[model samples]
Target: MWIKASGRAAMLGLKKKILEQLRGAVEQAQREGALPPGSLPDVEVERPQNPGHGDLATSLPLRAARAFRVSPMAIAEAIASRLPALEELEPVTVAPPGFINFTLRTRWLQEQVHHILSQGEAYGDLELGAGQRVLVEFVSVNPTGPVHVGHVRGAVLGSTLARVLEAAGYRVTREYYVNDSGSQMEVFYRSVWIRYQQVLGRDVEMPPGGYMGTYVVDLAREIHGERGDHFLRLDETEAIREIGEVALERMVQAIREDLGLIGVDFHVWFRERDLYQDSAYQKAMSMIRNGGYVAEREGARWFVSTALGEDKDNVLVRSSGAPTYFASDIAYHYDKFLTRRFERAINIWGADHQGHVSRVKAAVVALGVDPRLLDVIIVQMVTLKRGGEVVRASKRTGELVTLRELVEEVGRDACRYFFSARSADAQMEFDLDLAKRESQENPVYYIQYAHARIAGILRNAREKGLQSEEGDVSLLNTGEEMDLIRKLVLLPELVETVSATLEPHHLAYYALEVATAFHWFYDHCRVIGEDPADQDLVRARLKLVEACRIVLARTLHLMGMTAPQRM
Candidate 1:
């Protein structure tokens, strides 16, 4: 009763009505003596895998043979007999072993097609994640070298996840944590300084642990152009500091551009140096010490992470007074939890960082924040293959491939789609030949082609003046068209599920299905026909095609792909 009266309750009422209808139908069958009074077991209704099975199938009788104390066939017949034959069901059948198969009203699914057309690209959006604030931090690649194909996956995945979260109604912040204070950055600094010395007529050998990438020479050239002869005369550390800042900024810019090619933007660029220099680290040290998480040994400070399940105690501050990376990270989390106050902070890291997970989560927990508030998503490593040969990348050995090179070779959409097409936990191989040669076969292009094809159809239809009519939706009965409409209707449910599970690959898969549906529908049905009788029907089909276009456009846009007007 309350369900019928309240607007919000109306949604629940529909479900209750379903349960009530199933139960009443069973009870009435008992009164008619069609079977024993309680012959049918509890009903279980779920959407069917194949559309021919109807909107939902219930196999309760099969699962409850012992409880019903009867054969499954008898229960299926009992339930079938008692229920009012739903008009939505084409021909409800009872399979052997008591499976109640339903065939949904194609008209209802067809009607949803218009809802999407009316809703435009916002069709699948829901309010499930409203008012929730989530922080997604990823691709905070150390400011050492340019991005590599290895770094591209995390950026694409993180950006895509942030977009998915937003569509599901959460206020999501996409962030990049700059690792400017790390040892790798120092090596990069030294590498550039050595190149700077060489540019200044000083014969200097490449430092043992220096960055050997071609970018080092480019950075030195860039430094030379701007600072002239004066910058070359300074001491190594001083000159490196001046030139390193410029080099780091250039590197960050190059990184930003690489991400921009794929449509990812960070809301914040939290500098790691800020944690150390801005008292955030000191404040965190004080809190952790008070909490008994920090212990001193031989004039050095250590965070007793071993007590918190780490393999060993990690040094917070060394005897020479330099703070370790772990110490700065502790303070970063402290500020993130105590100051930024994200409901949940999700950090996407490579598989190599799996060992760092528990310590970070523990630090958040140790700082009085809920342990569940911190989430670490470790995306597995990516293997790069060129002509079936794996490209071995190592920054220390300077065997790495920069991300800009990958983007330039394969393009951004293909790069993002390929990485996000599989579960992050699964190791992926980036095949250069496949990425570059057969661009049309790329999943991103396939989906984009759907949108572009639809746009072309719409263009052709409009040119023919095929003014769409809001005709009776019942006219839509084609199998492929119905399948496509059904897929569109379930998109909202898919979004909710994908958001909750954090398996963004589901969206990638859905993108492929949606495009496939469009392709099938487009091949079979023409949106514009010359026959007078086919005009209104053609117009109606136009509406459906528009709905598909909207979905395809948004889906590709979310994946950071362009919906080319003409592919």
Candidate 2:
């Protein structure tokens, strides 16, 4: 039997459908002159934590009540009465305190299996952005050393956010801002020079606060191997400048390679030196001065942040006549918003830089752009554990744990998944033992197992001459089946939520829910059996399993984790 469009309700997704129903109800009430006329606020719909309340609950009536100057319960009742009949929705109910709850129709729930299969990997994509340009700059670690685990969280967060935005229809640019020009770069250069002299068996005092890691020694050895005793012929000034430039490039390349170990690559490696060389810094400073946001005090150029509600002014240029990092950052952002013309700019910084957030936004506002268009995500530190004991630093490097070592230890999938398993704002402890384990206790294993198990089921079904394209979706009516279908349908809405809120950690939680739903469905519903009378049921369940695979795979891919067909 063919499923007709008239019989199968069109799914606009649960949240969107509920919002439409609420908005339509208000419009209908207005048409009938049953309530005061006014535009409704953006309806916020979410799944009720307690399922008994309803599938989705909203406080739109309470919000609208204020605008219309009426009792919330009365407005809710009027809105409920005026709701148009929707096949996907059973009915809208008014709860206490003006909450509107909506339940899903059984047929509509069952139809989602078809919808998921029809849409496949494209099912969860949303149109929330509608093609806005969003530039996400993250893990812009200074090119002084290798990328350590400290940088891992921000890299994962930014990459996942970029993926989420792309799924939500935003034109995204994954970027890395290279601090290639600064005092740190000079320090790194001198560090390398000192190591070069030491490596050549010369008496040289190591600079104070120089990089002392084994990697620095390795860099010196590399330079020695390439040009033995050649730097001794050059003057100190020439050697410092020439060798520093070479070491900076090498360090940046090393950082890039390390990031690649964990599946991070940037569309643009924006160099800080470019901002100065291109005079973007001069132009930005002039713009701020023209806007009266720049002032000179005590021979130092200061950003007058008090006008933007800051308690004190921040220095842009020091009295010694050298521009501070803050000055370069202002220019970089000016290029981001005005030069590059990105509608929105998102910077992912370490938690230590949280103080810079307000100041940068103040600078953006002073540069004549909306500060709201700039978003700063501060990712807290991550602590790693091995065998229930804290692993503060990598034993091999004798310093912070390099992201490469973490990936080599737990594999890229585990590293990416575990690093992104928590909110960027929250500090997390990564269990090295659990990550390396191949048990269901590990979440990556658990989620990947569902996909692998479904793969096995699909293979068995194929050998038995069963296919979802020929299956009858109506055969899926079990409670477990409906619950799984409902969970699968929530992915698109979840993407929308993450894109709006800039939180990809929600994907991690949602993936676990999907995995749980799949596991539950598998336990209660057997997909393949030899019984001739149950062939239709077997075919339908196979289709459902395939749909689950699509969602599971999409979620994993979105988080930069692999969806393994075999574990």
- Estimate the overall C-alpha local distance difference test score of candidate 1: 0.78
Q: Looking at model 2, report the run of 10 residues with the lowest lDDT sum.
A: 1-10
Kindly report which residue pairs in candidate 2 clash with one another.
none
Candidate 1 has what TM-score? 0.88
Q: Which ten residues in a row are the worst by lDDT in model 1? A: 3-12
* Model 2: lDDT to the true structure: 0.86
- State the lDDT of candidate 1 residue by residue for 1-567, as single tens digits: 432241222222333455666778667766777646544555667777876566667877677567656688887787776767644355668876578876656665676665676667786676777668999999998877777778888888899888888887889988899999877788888888888778878888987877888778878888888888766677767887888888899988888887787677899999998887788888888998999998889899988987788788778889989888888888998878787788878899999999888888878777888988787889999899998998887766666777777888888777878888888899999888787765675677788788889999889988887766665566678988898886676666666666787777887788899999999998998778778888768878888888888877777766777787877
Choose the strongest candidate by TM-score.
2
> Candidate 2, 144: how far from true, in Å?
0.8
TM per candidate: 0.88, 0.93
Report the Cα RMSD per candidate: 4.1, 3.2
Error of 1 at 133 (Å): 0.6
> lDDT of each model, Cα atoms only?
0.78, 0.86
